[model samples]
Target chain A: MPDEQARRIVLASRPHGEPTAENFRLETVPVPQPGAGQLLLRTRYLSLDPYMRGRMSAAKSYAKPVEVGDVMTGEVVAEVVASDRPDYKAGDLVTAPLGWQTHGLSDGKGLRRVDASSAPITTALGVLGMPGFTAYAGLREIGRPKEGETVVVAAASGPVGSMVGQLARKAGARAVGIAGGPEKCAFVRDELGFDAAVDHRAHDFAEQLGAACPKGIDVYFENVGGAVWQAVLPLLNDFARVPVCGLVSQYNLAGPPEGPDNLPTTMAAVLRKRLTLRGYIIFDFAGLFPDFLRDVTPAVRDGSIKYREDVVDGLENAPEAFMGMLKGRNFGKLLVKVAG
Target chain B: MPDEQARRIVLASRPHGEPTAENFRLETVPVPQPGAGQLLLRTRYLSLDPYMRGRMSAAKSYAKPVEVGDVMTGEVVAEVVASDRPDYKAGDLVTAPLGWQTHGLSDGKGLRRVDASSAPITTALGVLGMPGFTAYAGLREIGRPKEGETVVVAAASGPVGSMVGQLARKAGARAVGIAGGPEKCAFVRDELGFDAAVDHRAHDFAEQLGAACPKGIDVYFENVGGAVWQAVLPLLNDFARVPVCGLVSQYNLAGPPEGPDNLPTTMAAVLRKRLTLRGYIIFDFAGLFPDFLRDVTPAVRDGSIKYREDVVDGLENAPEAFMGMLKGRNFGKLLVKVAG
Candidate 1:
């Protein structure tokens, strides 16, 4: 038991505006033994998502904020190190909400066994997991892009957006991707096979987007909801569907920006254009996981659906990686390698 | 030709903000004789709707704005005075999009014969017309309130909002109506049978709305977007459906309001609460007309659905009545009596 020490990061305090390293603290403690009907998990890979930024703030959101002095909550790919449960065996690869820790004890609830042979173990934390399902469900349920329609997605290099664009193309709709720089924009167009790619950070971003969307945007996958949303709003065609998954640009804002308020304008556009703007979390469509796997798994396996990963080694580095992801710094599905 | 004079109101100038009487010009012209395949229509009742305010401005909207010096466009109930078409005859009551003229010439393409014996001919302009169908379609198609859920509607004394509250009640849902004044609030509560009514003009309007909706708002029929929309936004429950039919309050704005903008807050709320905000024009759901007529016609016939008309006499008074309707001055369905 003395040798079974768990290294973990805990929330030191809630963030104001942008998160700093001072908000987190690293600690080591004796790993608790698995009780009856429980299993001991050793974290292999930790998912670092933009949503975790929301969990750091005390602000009201879909999920509760991670409390100060507690283990920062997250999903992790882990291996069963010890088991008192008959269903779980030692050395079994699995995925669970194990937080920012090297070792965790679970009562075997909400744990899904992962087949490492079918795909890499890290894919369980990225393309084959929550991020992937978010894109699948939001597109299928909300976006509903008909053939020959134009589907625009910002943060196009990220896991959710890449999936959305590819899925749109698969549905016979034109896919337009918006990214922060030339490299990511190229990746989104050349590698991901998007119909068009526009650099959001470019001086002529809005103009480029307008030119890209020749038929007007029919389905806009809204994740970055600031200037990108502003650019997409006017371009949206009548009866366009917007699947509002995230607002990464506004996550760090201390307060609403100055205006000439655009809320009325947005609502006016919504009314005049007959647009449908629907927001959703992946958990709401969890029942469609099997269908998502069925559709995406084949496309992914056949190389029609491409994925990229930006892995930052060590649980200690998760804070920096997550903060970077919020600012569009991470190139893809960001993950933290919790163990060697 | 001297006896066949037609008096009409035309758009003299586009209003920069709130419209004025100077923006309209009343003129009498010799009525153009009906050509082959056309019918001469003498307008009986003219509908003055909130949407007409949008038509008075040169701003881009779902429909083209009425050009300056053109007859201000609207729907009207009329009697066939002369027919060159085989289908229509003299004295037959019909509905057509005939603008603000006392006389009009139609090719009979969009005319629907109104059964004067079935219901009040005025009902064709109010409860049984575009306004009624708007409420029916928006509620049934977008709001989709389940039994026992809470449905909230603003401008609840108006044609559309009144119908929405009654329809929500018919569907076994709690209907909370928000109206401008005490009298209108009382009318919404007692006369219209809403579960609760909150006065938007009250100092403690938001607090009163919170008290009225103990379970939170599930469906908000958004026709009046401004302060009322601001108050209702925070009260919306997770997965609330907002069928945005109008924003009469913001229609008169020359430009966007000063802020602390709330657009990000709205988008964030949409994401956090998983809300669906859909905007629609009545014509978008025109296919549901027969269904609307079938469902609502009987309800009105049985006295289960009630209607009130704020009828202003004389076509010359249309500009004044329309201006009043925009300011929420009219008590119910505002209309102009064009003929004796």
Candidate 2:
């Protein structure tokens, strides 16, 4: 029998700095039937990303802020349980921006059908998903690492960074990963096949990073942007490219950090080195989605590009998992298994 | 008979903050004779650009710092008085990196013959030369403003900024220039044909800039950084491109300005707006010089792209003129008339 009740996590209040459990409210509602041209989607896997932190704040960003009562924004791998649309049918897997909800009613728009035969349906939210595509697009368009060039990415064990390292290696560049702990660093170095992995939590991280990048860094995929950026700045070679995807390190800050005013130094380095720092969101490269899938799906399926997930069971635990992910507690592509 | 003695400005001492006459020593030396396969060149017009400030410091930059006792690095429009090479360049005008000297010796390797018949030889140092090429290449490669988009450039009356404003207009973008005072602002808006102009010296400079760029800035040709950048930051529209060629305002600064750590704010804006901030030197686009000449030379000849030069007579006055140019004392392209 189909479950009558659906659960969703909504923004209860805006975060001042770090988002807490109180900021997210879990509520239960009756699963509504799909009317004309609508599909009833049952969430299978919900993707939790660092960018969601931006949406939780009232401050202006690329995406709209989630209001007090609205569902927290996220992408989800789901099953179409019932469909009135011509393109979708019952039992078909698809990915959609259905928020942090177990069930959602979609009017058959912006829903991408996920092929369950080639890979695990959950991969639709991860390795062959938005995070993976982000690394690919940013690198191809901006980073453009040449052979023997050093390409560095933080959050190394996470989906985006993992993909970035692997892609850099494929381009014949030296891939360097920066992760929080020794375990994640080992995984990035061993499992992901990056040339080197440095633990950002290490006391002498900057020195260790310098040691790892003997030739200096040519491409730094900037996601963790505070001290990591400060460390990477001096090591960046002339004509280096920095494709800024996220600033996870600075995302939780309620205000600017204590100052020596690093902007002048940053600008000076940029001018002297002829560096290119371009910031872009995944949606900006939406047109390349088909190309990304064509290239990455095969790589993931053939075991050439590997991905790991840290799955937390139950929709109610999303806030905790998300908060943990922000602090680098979650080890890999963070996901919430909402339902079967 | 050719003069046996020539005067050259040498870097006597490095400037701690802003450069002064004491830092430059007037050295009278015998004119260098061209050896086998070399050419003896007499300086005509020496370009005094803001980039020279970087050379004055011992700090690591794209170009090697000019050592103390060495002739200060500069580009000059010169006359090839004698050539031993097959090219036969006697009395031919050429533009070369001949430093701050009245006469120089070149191997003809990097010498490009200047066409004196087409335009005034001084134009090769101003409108039709390196400064103009800096504007063209930076805009085409980085600050690509589309039709009706707002483009802002600081130091509007100067060589680089003037060309940037005119090029932006040619691309059908609304060019808004920021100069030091009312006279320069009036020149930028009325004489240079910019859509609007704002004086950076005004008390309400930021507000005035905001008012000038009604639709917000799409392309910001950043040559003058510091407070000007702070003002433009909030006004940059989504996907705005900032092609950073120089940071003249901060060039003389001994250390970082006191602040609330604007880097985080800047990074946040870059991420939210998906902005592109790229820094480049003119040599990076040297291959595009011919393309630049083809596009700009005709327009300059037709009076569509007007240029003004502030020529300071005699090589000895170069130090004073260069120091004054840094403080925005010069009304146009700052040049030192070395020989004639």
Give the best candidate by DockQ. 1
Predicted candidate 1 versus true structure: per-residue lDDT over B1-340, tens digit per residue: 4477899999999998999999999999999788889999999999999899899887888899999999999999999999998899999999999999999999997888899888899999999999999999999999999999999999899899999999999999999999988899999999999999999989999999999999999999999898998899889999999999999999989888999888999999999999999999988988999999988988898899999999999999999989988888999999899996
lDDT of 2 by residue, B172-235 (tens): 9999999998999999999999999999999999999999999999999999889999999999
Worst 10 residues of 1 chain B by lDDT: B1-10
TM-score of each: 0.99, 0.97
Q: Write the per-residue lDDT of candidate 2 for residues A1-340, one digit (tens) a residue.
A: 3668999999999998999989999999988788888999999999999999999888888778899899999999999999998888899999999999999999977789888898998888888888999999999999999999999999999999999999999999999999998999999999999999999989999999999999999999999899999999999999999999999989999988777888999999899999999999988999999999999888998999999999999999999999999999998899999997
Residue range A27-108, candidate 1, lDDT tens digits: 9999978888899999999998888889989888889999999999999999999999889899998999999999999998
lDDT of 2 at A339: 92
What C-alpha lDDT do the candidate models reach, one value each? 0.92, 0.93
Reference-based lDDT, residue B145, model 1: 92
